[model samples]
Target: MTRIAACQLAPVPDGLAANAELTADAVREALAQGADVVILPQLVTTGGVLEDAEQARAVAVASGHGVFAAWAAACTARQGSVVVGGFCEAGDDGQLYNSAAVVDATGLRAVYRCAHLWDRERVVFAAGSAPPPVVDTAHGRIGVLVNYDLRFPEWTRTAALAGADLLAVPVAWPAAQPGEGGGPDGQLVAAATARLERVAVACADRSGPGWTAGSCIVSASGQLLAAAGPGRSAAWADVDPEASRDKLVAGSSDLWLDRRPELYDRLTAPRSTSG
Candidate 1:
């Protein structure tokens, strides 16, 4: 009976106060709507794809300064509620990472950094070492993947293999151009891709002119259970971990069950230039 909400709302650029308010509002709404876990999009506190110079290097608050802290405290106050959201993590070594924190009413649960940095992000954020997948509270083995992380199937595959029942993605996906008209693929591709592993993939993507419009949830066999409206809304859905597991156990796919790593190694063998 764990219902997670993937919020799709407009978070103003560099507007921490506004973002915090928005996050609190969403958390409240999710709880009111009977959500056990409420997942927010990446950079929920600080707007992503920073454009302004001053905004580009915005420092991360110490689990106390801004929205991240505010959200954490709010979640803790909610008793049974938990929150998973992203923000820039300021490390003790003085490095800022593109990171996400899994929090509950008690405070921080797990902090995951983005291992794969996309386009402009590499220039501003330091990467984190990819850690072995771990379950958060045993309700289900949870794993985190930032936006660009979804492009690589192995990332999701490894998590599934490592016992992740729910693969959560937080993204600030971009809206297709004025006329290009290819609606967001976060869900379409994730669901299609997850069909390979037969795992549930849930994503909280941003909306409006700054980010992609669609936020969605995919079933264990890649079925679209729910989708957010175009731009600024929450996508609500119920994910039965048991059902996801059941589908994987019953479904047939070459994803992990029929892997032939040995053959792949030879197939992808590098060729020598010295012929």
Candidate 2:
């Protein structure tokens, strides 16, 4: 069983130093609770709000250096727990990306650039064109999805099809508007996705003034295992990676074996509009 920790942080807007410190504190706190892996909210290292794309690009850092070095050190000290979190990444092509990384005692294991951009994000960040690789870790085969990626069924399904037992999501989810469901959109989607994909999912979301703070850990069967309510908190859960591999829905209804992929060619075809 893999014990996972999801951290809900309320970052100080535009305060990088304070955010890093807060992140470290959360990591330590999660570790103290016996977490095998810790996941933090999107852009927790440098806070989510930025003046413009220029500011975001300027603050982006390379993996395994600076802020990442500190996070890696924290994981190394724990000697086992893998830490996954989001940040402003300086890509190899000199562009900026909203990215997430997985770190363990061995060092940086995987990095994922958010493929789906949300609202203002498209103006400040470049969307990733490819799916992130599934990482083989001590706990399980881990995959990463960013904030808006959760809205795309194909994204998570792709990860699960690639044998990812766990999906770690780092998000800065906004609260439901005045007349909405009074619950964050992330909550329902996370649960639904986990149920459909049969993969254990952990989402770490930022909590603050206008955010919903809907961080949660879901079992392979889509059960809400743990949740961090409306404040800065940590949610923990124990999951068996192998359990997700079972594609059985009932007596003889298997998820994977019953696939009819041959008829799914249209899924990849571009749509045409009527003139």
Most TM-score-accurate candidate: 2
Best by lDDT: 2
lDDT of each: 0.71, 0.84
Alpha carbon lDDT of residue 77, candidate 2? 59
Candidate 1 colliding pairs: 75-105, 76-105, 173-212
Per-residue lDDT tens digits of candidate 1, residues 1-275?
45778888777777777788988888877877777777788877776566532455574645545565566667654566777787766677677677777776666777788888888888777887876244565346567777787877767776777767778888777765322324566667778766876777878888777566577777776788888857547777777676556533435753455677677665446876894
RMSD of 2: 2.0
| Global fold similarity of model 1 (TM-score) | 0.84
Q: Could you list the CA RMSD of all candidates, in the order they appear?
A: 3.7, 2.0
**Per-candidate clash tally:** 3, 0
Candidate 1 residue runs with Cα over 4 Å from true position: 52-54, 62-69, 76-79, 177-182, 247-275
